[model samples]
Target chain A: MMETDWLLGFAGGLMIGGAAALYLLVNGRIMGASGILGGLLDGSDRAHWPERLSFLAGLIGVPLLLAPLWAPETHLTGNPAVIVAGGLLTGIGTRLANGCTSGHGVCGISRLAPRGIAATVFYILAGGVTVVLFRHVWGLI
Target chain B: MQRNLFALLAGGLFGAGLLVSGMVDTSKVQGWLDVFGAWDPTLAFVMGGAILPMAMAWAVARRRGVSLLGTPIPARAEPRLDHALILGSVMFGAGWGLAGLCPGPALAVLGFGGWGGGLFLLAMGLGMVAAPALRRRLDRLPA
Candidate 1:
């Protein structure tokens, strides 16, 4: 169950890349989820809410519409505290860093931007350490 | 209208890609992170697949000041490797390891990830709302 199919993953990643590319060419925006949603929530980019909303509507709404067809498995943690802690960290951290996997990992790395590359490396390394600490040492999760 | 349509299309495609790629699965994400245990390398391919076309897009973007639709290409943020960037990334990473959910997959799985997913989204939204003030406070602290 833990094993992932590389072909599907690659194909799907291609779609994600295509979407980012399309977003860049057409809307002239980086397709970063945290940035897009954060801008709307924090009122930093209120003027462009319409475009953001349209984009999000498709992002969330389409997955829901297709939920029956794909029914993707999401192995979320059962602990309420873990869930809350995870959410808060993700929210605050992404905003503070000014990007997430999409902005820094995909878009930033593609452009060879220093910030994106550095952020990507930092987050992934941090994530690995966290996993070791929590899952291996602490066994909290 | 056209731009909005494109945005919609792009978003839909992005979400679909996440779903198809098995990224919406928390176990898959966690599995990739579990190097000490059984590690899954599918994520590497996903990142690679995404970077290829985006690299091309960036190549094109380098030549033009404006998008094909005539809007200015949004400038990249400052490249400075500041404390905030490092601190935030570390925190985000910790959270990611704990939950196996990031903002994108968290949203993508809302429909299927059930009540837990909903709870995570709500909490994350609150955190995002609180972040500006947090950053301001952090900035005021003696360096």
Candidate 2:
């Protein structure tokens, strides 16, 4: 089961990388999910709104179309406070940092960019520590 | 027109990848982060797999200088380390640990994630809207 899961993950990663490649090669954009969405929201990338909207349409629409077949599950927490807090933090953090997992973790590190590498390390470390604290010590989540 | 079409295709591919890779599963994400517990290392494969093609893409991009659509490729980002990167990352990490959902998956899961997903998305949008003001305040503080 674990092996199967790992294989699936790898395959999916390949698809993600392929998508990034396509976006960069064809569109000349970095394919950062947060930046793509945040730009629209903050009015920073209004000039490229059509492209961003086109991208988001597929991002949301494909999954919506596939949901019946895939039955994707988030298994998110039931706690409203936790959910809200998590959402807010993720939003603010990603925007402030100007990237997220897709941007910094995948694209940034792949290109050997220092900022991407540093951001990935810090976030992963912080995530580990948070898990230890919240899940282990606090048992809050 | 070609740019929009390709962008849509890329987005579809990305969304599919998130679902297939089990990235939409909050438990899988939190479990991977749970290093001291029954940690799931599958995400490592995903990360490694993703980096492979992107690395090649970067190499090709360096030589080409422009996309196939004739748009200038974005320049490499500055290497400077600053307070915003570190601080925002820590906050993002904490939020990720708390909910096991990041930006991409958060949006991707909206179709089937039910009310919880909707609420999270709403809050996330609100936070994004408010971030600029907060960022201005943070910039004022001595680094």
Candidate 3:
């Protein structure tokens, strides 16, 4: 089961990378979810709204369709406070930093860009520490 | 029309990839992050897998300079180790650790994550909507 999960993960990653590559090679866009959504919201890049909207429509819409057939068992915390706090933090932080996992982790790192690499390292480390603090030290979350 | 179609295709593929990779599974994400607990290292494989093809694509892109559609590839960003990057990343990381959902997976899982996921998505939108002003304020701070 674990091995199957790993294989599926790797295959999925390839598809993600391929999608990003297609976005870049075909449309000349970065396939960053936060960047795409944030740009639309903040009015930073309105000129590209049509393409962005189209892209986002697929992002949100396709999953809705495929999930029922190939869905994995998943669960989010039921706590409203945690949900809200996590959402706000993710939104604000990604926008402020100008990237997220997709932007930095997959796209940026692939090109060996320094900012992408640095951001990935920073966020992963911070995330690891936070897990330690919340789950081990403070017992929060 | 072609540009929009490509965008849609790319987005659909990305979303499907995310769903297939187990990235949309909150438990898998949190479990991967739980280094001190029964840690799951599957996320690393996902990252590694995603990076390989993208790296190859980038190599090709560097030589070509422009996309096949004649659009200019985005230039590499100038590296900046400033406050916003660190502080914001720390905050984002903490939130990710807390909830095990980043921007991509958070949205991808919305169809299945129930009301909690919906609320998270809503709050995330609000936070993103509020970011430009917040960023402007943060910019005025001392370095």
Q: Which candidate number would show the highest DockQ if scored against the true structure? A: 2
Cα lDDT of model 2 by residue, A1-141, tens digit: 999999999999999999999999999999888889899998977999999999888888888899899887788999999999999988999888889999999999999999999999988888889888998899998
RMSD of each: 1.5, 1.0, 1.3
The sequence of per-residue lDDT tens digits that candidate 3 reaches over residues A17-113 is 9999999999988899999989999889999999999998888889999978986555788878888988998898898888899998999999988
Task: Assign candidate 3 its CAPRI class.
Answer: medium
Better of 2 and 3 by DockQ: 2
> DockQ (Cα-based) per candidate?
0.83, 0.85, 0.80
Model 3 chain B lowest lDDT segment of ten = B78-87
Compare candidates 1 and 3 on lDDT and give the better one: 1
Model 1 agreement with the true structure over B113-143: per-residue lDDT tens digits = 7999999999889989999998887777665
Question: After superposing candidate 1, which stretches have Cα over 4 Å from the reference?
Answer: A1-4, B140-143
Q: What share of the true interface contacts does each candidate keep?
A: 0.81, 0.83, 0.78
Best-matching candidate per TM-score:
2
Displacement of residue B73 (Cα, Å) in model 2 is: 1.0
lDDT for every model? 0.89, 0.90, 0.86
**How much lDDT does candidate 3 score?**
0.86
